[model samples]
Target: DAYGAIRANQGLYLSSWGQLGASGDQLDLTPARQQLDSAYHLSDSLSQSAQDHNADALDSRQNLKQAGDDADDRYGNSEQLSDADQSNARGATDSGGRGEAARMKAPWLHLASPAGITLSTPESTHLAQGRSLSISSGEDVNIATGKSLVASISEKLSLFVQKAGIKLFAARGKVEMQAQDGEMAFTAEKGVKVTSTEGRIEINAENGILLQSGGGYIRIEGGNIEVHCPGAADLKGAQHNFGGPTSLTRTQPEL
Candidate 1:
C-alpha cells in the first residue's frame, strides 16, 4: 500500500494501483532468479551453434586437384571425393552467404568484396588443372585498384576462343607480349591494321608469307620498303606500286 512504481535490472517487474504481484526478483526472489539464469545459458548454446557453421565453411585448406594430374598435396588423396565430402562443402559455403558453386571456384582467386582477403606466401600459388577457367557476370564487372595490374603466364597454348573477347588498355605504358624463341601471329576475321604515327614498323618471316586483304594477294606500304621474295609472288589489282630489287628471280602471278 506504499509503492506506486517498480524498477528492475535482473528480471521483470510491474507496479500499479496497490496490486503488485509479479514473478520478478524484486517482487518474488528465488524462482525468478533461477528461471532467468537458465534462459541466459540457453541463448548461449544457440549462438555457439551458429558459430560452428561459420567455422565449418572456412576451416578448409586442403590440397585442391583436378582431373588427370599428379599430386601436389601429400596429405590429401588424389581419388574422387565422397558424398559426405560434397555435403560438407555445401554447408561450408552457405555459411558465408554463398552457394555450393563457391567451392569449385576457390583454386583460382575469385575474390569479390570490399575489404577483400590476402594470400601471402614465399612460394607460388599454382592452378595446375587441365580444365578451363571461366568468369561471368550478368552486368559489367570491374576490377580496379590504385596500383597496376600485372599478370605473368609462363606457358602459351592456343590463347583465343571464338565468341569470346578480351580487351586491355594501358593509360601510361606499353602493352607488350614476348614469345621467347617463337613467333607471334595475329589474325582477324574482318581486317587487320598496323599503324604508327612517329615510329617505324617491320615484319620479318623466315618461311613464305601469305596475306589476305583488300582484293589482293600481297599489299605493302612503306617509306623505303624492302621485300625479299624468292619462290613466287601473286599480286591481284588493277594498279600496284611495287618496288623491289631489279634482279628479282622467278616472280610469277598465280592468277
Candidate 2:
C-alpha cells in the first residue's frame, strides 16, 4: 500500500509508549515485534496533551537519519536495494519503469490568501539551513514596521541590481554612512555625482582628499592645494579673486 489512514470522529488521540495524556491516564500501547525490530523505530514520543474533544498535539523525537533517509522504509525494503532488485521492482510496476513516474506529483506547497496570513509566536521562530532560503513574489516584497529594522552582519553585505540602480531615500530623516575602522568606497562605471537640491555639496576629510580624472589630480592636504593637469587648465569666470597671497610658480596657457 502506498498510504494508510486513521480517521477519528472527534479528534485524533495519539501518544508514545512511555507518555500519557493530559488526564495522566496510562494506556498500555505496545508495538508489534517487527515494529520494535526496525531501524526506523528508534524514537521517543514525548506526549500529546489534549482535552477530550478540543485540540490535538504530537510531540516526538527520533533519530535525524530516520527522517532524512527512509526511502527503503517507504518502499517496504529493509535494506539497500541491489541493481537486480531495483530492476525487478521496476519490471513489476510497468513498461520502461514508468510506474515510478506515477509517484511523482507537484512538489510545491502553495498558499493563497485574499486577506493575508500573518504568523505570530511568543517564542522565537527559526529557519535552519539545509541549502538556502529564498523569498520571491510576483510584485513587491516589503518588510516594514512602525519601528526600526536592524541587520547586524559579521561579514560583508552585498546588494545587486540587474537593471535599475539602487536608491536610498529618507522622507523625513537624513541618510548617514560611517566606516569605523575600515574604508568606505563607491565605484561606478560611468559618472558619479554628489548633488544637493537646496543645500550645499560638501566634502570634508580629516586626513586628505584627492580628486583625480584623466591622468590629472587635485590633491588637497592640510591648507595646501595641488593641481596637476596633463592638458590645458581653464579658469573661466567674470571675476578672478584670491583671498590669500597667491603664487604661480609655472604659468601655462588657459584654454
Error of 2 at 249 (Å): 26
Which residue pairs show backbone clashes in model 2?
Answer: none
**Model 2, span 96-124: residue lDDT tens:** 33212111011222222334557789876
lDDT of 2 at 187: 71
TM-score attained by model 1: 0.30
RMSD in Å for all candidates: 22.5, 18.8
lDDT of each: 0.38, 0.45
lDDT measured at residue 220 in model 2 versus the true structure, 0 to 100: 82
What does candidate 2 score on TM?
0.47
* lDDT tens per residue, model 1, 1-255: 776954333323222313235221123222323433443344344335545543121111112122101111122122334422322333333344221211111122212222333666886677665744423232355877576677776653323322346677777778667755656667567866788778988554433455553444443433223444554556598987868655323443232
Choose the strongest candidate by lDDT: 2
Backbone collisions counted per model: 1, 0
